[model samples]
Target: MTSSTPQTLYRKIWDQHVVTTRDDGTALLWVDRHYAHEGSFHAFDQLAASGRKVRRPDLTVGVADHYVPTRDRAKGSAEPEIREMIRLLDANTAGSGIRLFGLDDPDQGIVHVVGPEQGLTQPGLLIVCGDSHTSTHGAFGCLAFGIGASEVAHVLATQTLWQKPAKTLRITVDGSLGPGVTAKDLILAIIAEVGADGAAGHVIEYAGSAITELSMEARMTVCNMSIEAGGRAGMIAPDETTIGWLKGRPAVPQGQAWDAAVAQWQTLKTDAGAEFDREVRIDGASIAPTVTWGVSPEHAEPVTGTVPDPAQAGDPGRAAAWEAALDYMGLAAGQALSDIRIDRVFIGSCTNARIEDLRSAARVLDGRTTVIPTMIVPGSSAVKRQAEDEGLDRVFTASGAEWLESGCSMCAATNGDMVPPGERCASTTNRNFRGRQGPGSRTHLMSPAMAAAAAVTGHITDVRRLGDVR
Candidate 1:
């Protein structure tokens, strides 16, 4: 008697996209959608060199997020290279009849943010972008991973990519989140527990009662950091939450088509007893708001916890690593996490710039003032418009925060946003890698509320203690 193979959502999506299988463990899988940005110039160059036109311009989209100035995009970029990149995107996509969301497009925003909003990111699609945060699209029940420049060109020319299927890992977070706990906190806590490479060589699909209960935007925040956990991609099966969110979106099918599309999306879950390469469990309610004190996403701890002590490092290697991190961060061992001073604060990034995230930060800052400089950048122009409509911009700016336009501002400082040398910043963006924000910058990754707390106190803080700050 033969046992039946269990079906998983990951495998199901993979099977749906397989165009051909080769003997060398390679498969040509059709790409359902591709998002590109300024960094894709090299890929376009490669496509031109191959004398090939984009195979499916309809399936491809472009955004000017990476190098567009978030502050003054309207007057055009002062930097010639930046201006050239934006112009090239316009020319290339127009020449190919592909839609481009340029600097002034009403739909223009961070690529990841815009995709879901535009109905381009959908369940069962195989998506790729030149940016690592493409995993962000996975929240919508799709397979999305960042590809290299060459792979970008290949996908452009053929509308498919040669790939190997990755092992599957399922992480289940149960129970309700604790007070002040957020999707950002939950993901940070997970990375810290599993270490930076814990999910390496696999695709992670998050599930469980808590995950299912989360809002679509919150789920996106969780999946957005899948790459930081070293996973090839992250996914969450689409359900009612996803269906409801996509139902009225302009890009989604409507009328009878909408009904049929959602009917298919409803089936996109891992079947019971479906085996995975690995599994992990977390108790969501036990999670405290977390913050990264060291250099990587794994280097995070509860905001209420103490700074890591290198002396407690288990081995010489680990100790040296801890010591080095502390020194580079201008920190000493055993310091309280909430006591660390910060010179700046940033509350924007694909990871946490959604409307809900901005509201969370605003809630913490109600009737308060920032003790230091702070900047609040929305993930897209639409998000900015929504914030303004809700009076969130006034609340933020009234409290000493700069309300800037969207476009990955200060998330990586790619377009003129920078942290002064030797200064520390409490940032809601993912990654605390050395100089990720700017030269000699020390970035502590936290939730938007936590970042807002730091802005008010001028130090790393626990938002739960805002009562005391008040």
Candidate 2:
């Protein structure tokens, strides 16, 4: 018998793609697209050792972002470890006849960004990547998630994966957000309220007045961190924003195919009267510019708030954890948030470095000068070129912010752009774990505007107070 309960966009897609059911209650789901990065080296190595060929070359794509140096794009060779991984991926793709977008290709960028930009990420499709932020593609109303190395190998050997269905959680944010508050702020607040593991073993469907009002880029920003919040994936129903963004993309269908694709996508939304395993509602107007002072994304607060006092924490274990984080971060309770100084500002990452993000940052930096070292790294070469063509680069340069080539530079310090020991930074990257940006480097997570404000003031300052851009 067919289920009658209202289904989330995720469940509808999952149910449609289920190929077989196992005795263990897991279903074999077909994957439409599989994205691989330098991190997929282990999977490629395993396939080679097993004398197995990639099962579906047409469905697989490879890119080099996580380990490729952003500054040295002209270099044909990378560091030894990265070089070997790149070599393996190239060889595997060639041997398997898989389509790969190499480093030299202008289309090459971060896998997550490249997939959507190329139109590979479409509504109602199952997409997987080796990197965790793959959920970014779910903004198109698709089912997307990150897979483990072993799972990567399994998918490469077979175009299907084993998985148990996850329950759905609906997060609804109503009302309009105040000025200076962005989708980043909304998600940060949700993570803080729910804790890091709140959505474990669940898929989060974001619906509400606030989410509906967000641009496609903003929706992507919120969905990108679903994994960090312990959700399998995050998705928003397809709407005009999604269609407008997908139109004319290189990989998108054209003419009659396009019309048919849109028609199918229109059916991908949640049915009326659908029921979710859990539901949550939040007021969008109450959200403020958020920043993380502790190690986890859940440990975030408003930019104007004070650091939490370990002594004031009610739970002994939590208090100890707070004390440890405070000690590691060199933060004191009762100190004004504005009093915290920052030595660096990074305005790019897989989480917040899209073209729209660059435009917002450029607006904030216009006619302003930054005292701290600030840098803006576009997510991809295409985004970089677009920013340059629009003269956004000039605005950043005028503000004393370094405009750099694309790739994951300074996001994780994988390529030598890192904060010095004991230095503090306001960054736009997703994670703020210990030593994430560099060894002993303290990172305070903020939105692009907040990062820009801190860059100009050389401290953790409130961005809303900066007034209108001239």
Candidate 3:
């Protein structure tokens, strides 16, 4: 049934997984991989009540993230409910014969981080999880996205999901990224150009020279925040960079099988002249080190720019929203971005907690100590080990930063890791929504280097402005 018509990478993957389609345009997609975390308890409960066992235990994995503590795991969580959540994940996964990466497992980490690290995420696979950051897996050219609790339950029972086709969007970033500009800054700038809901009812496919030049980690960082833009998911065409990174991963094919897999992956690119529902072009050189000034990621501005004035907004509805966000963020319109002081800093999350991110922050903190409180949480146990091996941990520790265990710490503030009320934080995690880190907490989202710079100066300082680290 293969057609000669030009097809996008997303369309190719989606078509491959269609189990069936209804008369109303809804299709049942076969789930290739499903990862469950602590928050999936409700799904498991639903499955239990339905009297159905997991159809494919081998295709399911349980990760103890979200509610898992980043510190003192041996003693478990102080809160009884949090402890029970972890325990329930263990019980459910064990009961269903599904592999569980518990808190004590050496491979334990955030589900999105662990998936690719373990090679469970692969090109052309249809992946899903209860967590919104499931889009992170799409970096490998997969059609991955988040699913709700009921969807999770259905997948657990049938290994299939009913979904409507989303419009395809190709966001091409041409040219090379300038010095100090990163994938985080690029994504922030894109979100700002198109408002928060600009990509609604669409799936984004990142392309062009700039995107191809980015490392697999940078691609993951970009795809990870697609949910923030109200997108169904985000994807990048598989290439040499992706194959090289997946070469020796434990869960990937091996020997001759690996060669065959790479051969098939090579054809995963979008055909020339493929028609997209929409298209956007961005000049990478024009992007600057970006940061969020207000409550939304769309409130991003360059480090050299000033806070936006609500009254200047052309649309009245947008102006009102800007006013409310400015009030909640406690910022004055037209104020210099660098003048904003931060009470603390966080450098970890599915978005920017990989070894490269750690290295970037370490470079900025080489000889400089942080002026304010700072915490560093790795994405996974493997990343933590790699950082320690490279002495990046020492670099962070030397800079007066607290180096903690690996998990989704401080990003979601679900496991007792939270910023004190009314405090401002420079964080590498995605999203700057009000109370995201904690109640009454203000979050300023930026790249790891930017956050490290803010930590050293106690203000939102640009990494490029720091004369020299050596």
Candidate 4:
């Protein structure tokens, strides 16, 4: 493609990183960043067995999140195998000369959160990680995606990845969001409309007024869940909001270089008349505060709606899935979603554990006490400190919630933090898959404010019903 060719942000970024293309259309693309966590030990072990070293240690980063305990920092995880995984990440990153944000590091957090917080995730760059939520970095207009263990090893050794290009899908959301609605609700609604695997083999570019108007943190929340929709990755063009959020960060360019970088980033958008393989549009105003009712992210509906009846489903397959989900969740058809009581409330994850998310939850919990047990974990140590400094931790604790350390705690269910068996939880995390939090753990995914509302009421409550939460 030439300069005159109309191109999407995904196409532009993909073209820039292409090192070579095979006859079958597979391309070897240069990787600008690689992030690893405890789960990445397998990839590192592969490198060791093959007698290879990281090709670009300077561009690689290691963080301890998935296995690190949120309660005890000094002793690490209680399980021996979990402790070993954390130690291996420390040793592997150290041996490879890669920077590590370990348990004691002030910046230690989820790899996805740490990357953007440190300004290591830049626009027009190609980034990869061993975790599916690596697409979170695509909020910066980058071509970021997750790779398998073997693919992770390849990127580490060669600094490039062989990939089959994904077709572009542009999802445009117009109009302004109504009061009390959030990016999390918007994304859940999208997933529900498109189904779980609707965007398979596609890279999604979120556009239109509603997307552009979101804060950097909110955009990250939307892109973070693209994998739930079966999208290879999700991207939003970098605008003034993205650039302004990235400026003055520790790892970003400074002074003259900063100006130059911004200039280049400003061009990372879909050119006029560029055509996508598929296009989808959603009216932002129509979306209500949403939550998952069943096993998948696509099993979402507004809190005002009732549980779906399998008999009402248009297809037999869909009906069967719904029936199974309801049985597993111990829910009856036609029950009001808002009437569903929860046993716990969890407010944390790379998706909604940022400072803004904490504030939103805190706003609702300020003078109210949770009816059930509630756990609030920050996404990173930096976010933890910021929340504490702002007295958000005090709000949570005052509301009878547990204020804990930062990590991917209670999100991936890798750490000890978990919802009890057969208990339902109103959570702010991205996924609601069965057993995602723990064995027999029932999850209802919602926004932080919605989760807080659930905490106070002990049921799924529409945030808007609590009066103005804005």
Ranking by TM-score: 4, 3, 1, 2
Clashes of each: 0, 1, 0, 0
- Once superposed on the true structure, which residue ranges of model 2 sit more than 4 Å away at CA? 76-78
Off by over 4 Å in 3: 468-470
Q: Per-model C-alpha lDDT, please?
A: 0.90, 0.87, 0.93, 0.93
Best candidate, lDDT-wise?
4
Query: Could you tell me how far off, in angstroms, the CA of residue 17 lies in candidate 3 after the best superposition?
Result: 0.7
Segments of candidate 4 deviating more than 4 angstroms: none
Residue-level lDDT for 189 in candidate 2: 94
Across 237-263, the per-residue lDDT of candidate 3 in tens digits comes to 999899999989999999998888888
Residue by residue across 1-470, what tens digits does model 2's lDDT show?
36777766887899888999988879999999999887788898888899887888899988877766666567744567666766777877877898887777787777787888888898889999887899898888999999999999999999899999898999999998899998888889999988799999999999998999999889989999898899989999999889998999988899999999999999899988888899999999999999999888988999889998988888999899888888888999877787899999998888898998888888789999999899898988888889999999999999898987777778868766788888898999888888988999899988998899899999998888999832
What global local distance difference test value does model 4 have? 0.93
**Model 2 lDDT on a 0 to 1 scale:** 0.87
Position 312, candidate 3: lDDT: 95
What are the per-residue Cα lDDT tens digits for candidate 4 across 277-332?
Answer: 99999999999999999999999999899999999999999999999999999999
Look at candidate 3 and tell me the lDDT of residue 286: 96
Per-prediction TM-score: 0.97, 0.97, 0.99, 0.99
lDDT of 1 by residue, 1-470 (tens): 12366778899898899899999868999999999888898999999998999999999999878777877667877888778888888888887788888998987999999999989899989999999999999999999999999999999999999998899999999998877889999999999988889998899999999899899999999999999999999999998889888878878888998888888888888989899999999999889989998888898999888988988878998789888898999998888998899999999999999999999999988788999999998998889999889999989988999998888878878887888888999999988999999989999999999999999899988888776322
